[model samples]
Target: MREIREFEERLQVENTSGEIPGFLHLYTGQEAIAVGVCEHLSDIDYIGSTHRGHGHCIAKGCDLNGMMAEIYGKETGLCRGKGGSMHIADLERGMLGANAIVGGASPLAVGAALSARTLGTGGVSVAFTGDGGSNQGLVFEAMNMAVVLQLPVIFVFENNGYGEATGHDYAVGSRDIAGRAAGFGLPAVKVDGTDFFAVHEAMGTAVERARSGQGPSVIEAVAMRWRGHFEGDAMLYRAEGEVAELRANKDPLTLFLQRVEGQVLQEDIEAIDRQVAAAIDEAVERARAANPPSAEQVLTDVYVSY
Candidate 1:
């Protein structure tokens, strides 16, 4: 969680200073959802992520330097600096790539799940989508397809209060992503995304069910984002002090440390914090020193013609 928080916080600074280019979304407040769930997955499993995907990439074990360089548009990045912040992918890591389009990756996850079941690979696929994305027709279709096919997929809806600037309360017609999932024949559960244990337990149940061939499930993690949807967003739609209140009372990292004070030593936590910070600093420096993709490399990764 600390690693993800630090990474996104650094991205916020870098994006503001023009070191990072293009549309960048931070996974600031919702660290636990990614870490908690991904703690169970392995390279045999797969995950499809959303536009706000930095956390998923980190939790799924993508290299930090590559991620930083990818965001910086450097040639050494995970996608050779082509995919940038929204589309970091590593097939060997089972990260199916982050989608720039909302709800886009859900179908891709379904495809992965289909492949897994067909190949008898025992791999479960996860689709991480936002509250706003839950409204898309593609997401619904993906859910229905998973249920019908009995695919080993988990629809992880990271319901981060708002989708962009619009509150989930206002935008989601069902007003309950989990309820909607249940309607699609998925055993759905809503967990407190801020609570790492809760998300982990819920995800464990869903993962077990999928791996055991009980079919697909849904986990709607109600985590709230600290920043605006994108870096430059004014966030004018929010009430004054709303974000501040969330940061103070609902910070997942602080909550995690508080909850695990006895099990994890304070000095150990501090040591980890320092290490994460230093590593992030090094990643940023390396990205700064790296070269951007030359003109010839632009078309290389875009398509695969038969």
Candidate 2:
């Protein structure tokens, strides 16, 4: 949890300083979901991330230096300064990139799982979408398709209560997101997204089901966002002190710290903090020194052999 907090703080600094161009979607309060899910995954497994994907990327073993550089839009970035904040990807790490469109990655993850099954690769695909995206038609289609194909995949719905500025209660007609998945003949479960052990346990069950050819399972992780939808949102819709209260009382990092305090020493947490800080600082220096992509390079990768 200290590691998660360290990354969140680094991301906050970058967002506030305008180091990460375009939009900055924060995952400040949803760390446990990513950490717990990724803990059960291997390097060969694929994960499709959402707009708020820094936590997922970090948990999947993506290099912090490259992630920071990518967000800064530097040539040394994972996407060579072309993808910027919304589309940072590292295929070698099995991160299918962060999707900008709502529910866009759902079908993509299903397709990846289908390919894995077809090729007998024994690899599973995981899609991490938000509460807002759960309403999209694509999510339903992907769910049905995964059941039909019996693909090894896990659908993780991080219900953070708000989709952009709109509340989930207003946007989604259903009271339970995971309940909707049962209609597609898939097993589903819900977990408190702030509890790492709960998420980890739920994901273990879901993954085991998928690997055994039982098809996909939906995991609804109910969580909250500590920050607004984006960096500059005035958040007029949210009530006063909502975010503050969540940060102070229900923050996943804080909860994890409290839970592990007796087992893990304070010095260990401090060491992680220092290491993350140094890593972020070095990434900023490297990104600043890196060159942007050339004008001609944009048109060069459009075709395979044209």
lDDT of 2 by residue, 243-270 (tens): 8889788878788888878999899888
The estimated TM-scores of all candidates read 0.97, 0.95
Predicted structure with the largest lDDT when compared to the true one: 1
Instruction: Please state the error at residue 48 of candidate 1 in Å.
Output: 0.5
TM-score for candidate 2, residues paired by index: 0.95
Cα displacement (Å) at residue 85, model 1: 0.7
After aligning candidate 1 to the native by TM-score, how far in Å is the CA of 254 from where it should be?
Answer: 1.1
**Residue pairs in clash, model 2:** none
Report how far residue 302 has shifted in candidate 2, in Å.
4.0
Q: What's the lDDT for residue 298 in model 2?
A: 66
Clash pairs, candidate 1, are: none
Give Cα distance to truth, residue 35, candidate 1, Å: 0.7
Q: What CA RMSD would candidate 1 show?
A: 1.2
293 Cα displacement, candidate 1 (Å): 1.3
